[model samples]
Target: MNMSDILANKVVVVTGASSGIGRAIAIRAAEHGARAVIVSDVTEAPREGGEPTAAVIEALGVTARFVKADVSKRTDNDALVAAAEDLGGVDVFVANAGITLRTDGADVPEEDYRRLMSVNLDGPLFGAQAAARSMKAKGKAGSIVLMASMGGLVGAGITVAYSTSKGGVVLMAKSLADALGPDGIRVNAVAPGTIDTELLRTAAGIAEASEGFRKRTPLRRLGQPSEIGDAVAYLGSDLSSYVTGHALTVDGGLLAVI
Candidate 1:
């Protein structure tokens, strides 16, 4: 069977689908033939693939819906699972919601640190819990992919709490993989390096020379949101049935510290 159709008839939910990696994953997941595509995020504005994402999925002749909710809230996470169940239950979940700290060491305010932790750390934890519960109760196999960062695996110059939160997500996926494996649920993570997403452009300190910095990588280029989308599709699809508890780096060899 074609890999594009690996997710055929499967229902998937993607958090932070308003833009960046989450939006790309949603679109690619629909392209992969997921029967139902549910997108969730805190914002209501026109994201790159907001209505367009739903439209594309519906064009593929599948079901698609967008929900506005703050992923940091436990109730909101439960609501996402509820929406999936309302649409017929979930087979895959992409916890792509995250935020970056705009300030460096001393400039990073304590309140900002707390806000970032709420969304980047607590959000994914609650998401994994909700998705795992839904999948476990279904008595069938499922997949959960969380968004980590190259910083999570190592460390960045000024990531501070952002790195810490992603580090938490990376370990969370591993722990979940170990805990939910016997139940047929596979958990994994995607750690992106420098990508040409709007988020990267607006990220705390790495915006100005992102393109130049991307070129300095061994690959002589930066990655793209679409690349991460493809990776998410793999983890979310049956194609990766045997892959779990691993953080697949999608950077252009930026993590290759030789």
Candidate 2:
């Protein structure tokens, strides 16, 4: 089947799409023919060139809307769902918003822990819930893809809170899949190894040993957002009708090697 026709006339919502992996997924979804793409972030206002990803989607012939909503905030999550409903209906919801921070037990503030949990862990949970509600209400039988990391799958150094938060997301996705499956809503998670996004540049060890990730990763380089986008597209499309409650790793074989 032609990939471009996979998502024709479907509506997709992507969070954290101001840049990075979220942006890549949004653009690719539109390219595959999603009727309307909601480019969500934490900023208000929209523009023709409001976002790099949305710009490309519009250029490729799809209606893209920008909605500013902080994933951590319940009201924001609601608004995101409302935005999609306003556009018509949502067939895919990409829970791609997240934040990262590092701190030792001694120096870590309670607020820091709270903030990370709110975004990394809690955000996806609430987003999935909202999407489920929308899908159930509309009887849309949709797809929801949660973004996770190697941190979620394995222990990384020093960032205990960040690692734990993503781990929660992994389970959250599975739980949603199990519960939503009866309603025909497929839920999945994408755990990418290391990518060249702005988030990776600021990550603790990645920037310090840029070459280390390359050498350690079997591919001998960082993963790309476009690669993750392809995986997301598959999961969101009919191609993955039988796939649910799975953590699809896009780590370039990093997890395969010792």
Candidate 3:
């Protein structure tokens, strides 16, 4: 069981990789020995103020390139996967781009709701579609990792649109797994709870609410981007060859007590 080079020689595509959990996932893929890491996002600049994700990954002695993409657009997803062909096609596609809207079902604006759903839900769906098609065309049994949320599994009035979208992501993974299984393509998801990221820090009621998140989690602390990164790396690697249609939770036991 020498699993040291888990994702070794794999070409991994990660979306929304400019910052946060997406950035960490791309970096971890390279660290895990991926042949090429495709850092796809609307921009290359990091939101938390650091070097771009591609540069950070390249520093790990791995092939890394920044591919500008808006995952919400189907064409962008297709182009992103096509870009992976330059590196001999994608071996793993991590649909990690997502957003949250703090609005209830009744109060969410139409424009805001559409944008949120397009990015949070349609992004992953289209990404998976394109990636799966590429994998099938290449006759490769690739892995697809969708980013779900703890909100997906549980209901919350504050995150109505967000939770609904992620809940779709959860079922989407399972449905995709079942459909793509015959083709040897594996589909799964990662459900993360409150993580310490720039996005979370900037949320409303930051200081007090962060403490509340900590208290609710069994681990008594917010999860880290790297933790989710490691989990996704596992899902993308050979270590999870037999795992599919599953939602791996990296929430520090937050859902356990809930």
The CA lDDT of each predicted structure is 0.84, 0.84, 0.90
**Model 3, 141-171: lDDT tens per residue?**
9999999998899976677788899999999
Please give the range of 10 consecutive residues that has the lowest summed lDDT in model 1: 44-53
> For this target, which candidate reaches the highest lDDT against the unseen true structure?
3
Instruction: Point out the higher-scoring one by TM-score: 1 or 2.
Output: 1
Using TM-score, give the best candidate's number: 3
lDDT by residue for model 1 (57-141), tens: 6776778898887989999999988898976688999899988876845457899889999999899889989998999888869
lDDT of 2 by residue, 138-193 (tens): 88889999999887898866667777888888898899899999999999999998
Task: Show model 3 residue runs off by greater than 4 Å.
Answer: 1-3, 102-105, 205-208
Cand. 1 Cα-lDDT = 0.84
Off by over 4 Å in 2: 1-3, 44-51, 102-107
RMSD to native for every prediction?
2.0, 2.8, 2.1
Per-residue error (Å), model 1, residue 90:
0.7
